[model samples]
Target: MTIPYGYAKGTVISAPSLKPTRRDHETQYHLHFSVQVADEVWDVAVNVGTNDSDDLLKYKLVFDYRHPLIQTLQASPAGKNDLTDVNALPALDFVRSDLLGTTGRWRDSAVMDGSDTPEPVASLTRLIEKALSEKFDVYVFGRFYSEGNGIHDAHMNQGSKGRYIHRPNSDQNDHNAVWQDGAVLIDCRQPEWAAYFAAFEQQYLPTDDLGNPTPSSSPIS
Candidate 1:
């Protein structure tokens, strides 16, 4: 039972902004950007970091990511689209698709609330600015909001373990699904594409068909 997943493609119309919030002793950092598809403006919220110092998240921004799915995504309709079939659609799957790279090329990036802009947010701002100036198409893949105003979950969505796994009544692990992963892909300058992928440090690789980590799975180094 996978959660509702989809992608939104549109043109950047507003400057990207970052907000850090603290609620119930937990910190969350979100990068926000606006996009106009047809006549509607949709909000794209990207998670940059968290307060988990021990298991810091792993992030990667490929400036020149090349994949066959880029062409398919570009041909899709603009605005928010809800993908029902995970196997048929062009959803992202870090472990299954190997979008980052076959080899071990992952990095660690953590953002905190501060007066100065962090590298992660700053880099995203630059890309959004460039897209605004060049009129490049911004493609966001994640879970669509129930209110139909925006989309989020712009990160990995599988391989949950320990407390992250779903309990009997909790929906925390509802996002764990194969081919329903989240990512941000940009059609920058013809023939060039930028891709952003993120995941928690404790998420294991070699997930099962259902996107759950197997007994022999291991965390990315």
Candidate 2:
């Protein structure tokens, strides 16, 4: 609940591409891309899986996301946005904001693979490509790097426990916050919005006001 760094907002200038990072002899999982905010191009990393494990239950993604929040995000300013209160703006809160909707719209990466449906990476890439071709306004949300022009954590930011909170060396609990969730939104500006959402199997819904898990919370099935 103590996210020291503020939220991330960017304007897509290039199509998203895959570029994996290596860490400690293991491949860090993510989809890399570039976004333009003003005159600078910032890197964007969206997690595709947990570590190197390709387990389908470990992740969830929604390709054609629809919500009332899309209208607000479509008109938001681009770039790294530092704000005093996220709840007052177009910020996201997966549980609180009902971004996932109630029709079980969230798709599991593994389930998609098993059912011959496009997986998270493929689905996201298709959206970005379409966004670029259609000249749609794209917005990416996450946390910006302190010394670099990039953003990561384009996924759910609450309901983590044990080692799933984050890296081992960091204060795991500090990364969770309400109304500051990470997401990627594509604004067609024609009353159509495509959104990409992700979450680990370990994350649960119904987070508290501080983004902590509640007693009645449950994982997305």
lDDT of each: 0.76, 0.63
Clashes of each: 0, 1
How high is each candidate's TM-score?
0.87, 0.76
lDDT of 1 at 42: 88
Candidate 2, 7-103: lDDT as tens digits: 4455566777666566443454577777777678888888765343433334444444677666666556665666424574466677765566643
Candidate 1, residue 208: Cα displacement in angstroms equals 1.8
Residue pairs with backbone atoms closer than 3 Å in model 2 (clashes): 56-110
Over 4 Å off, model 1: 21-25, 102-104, 162-173
Model 1 poorest 10 in a row by lDDT = 166-175
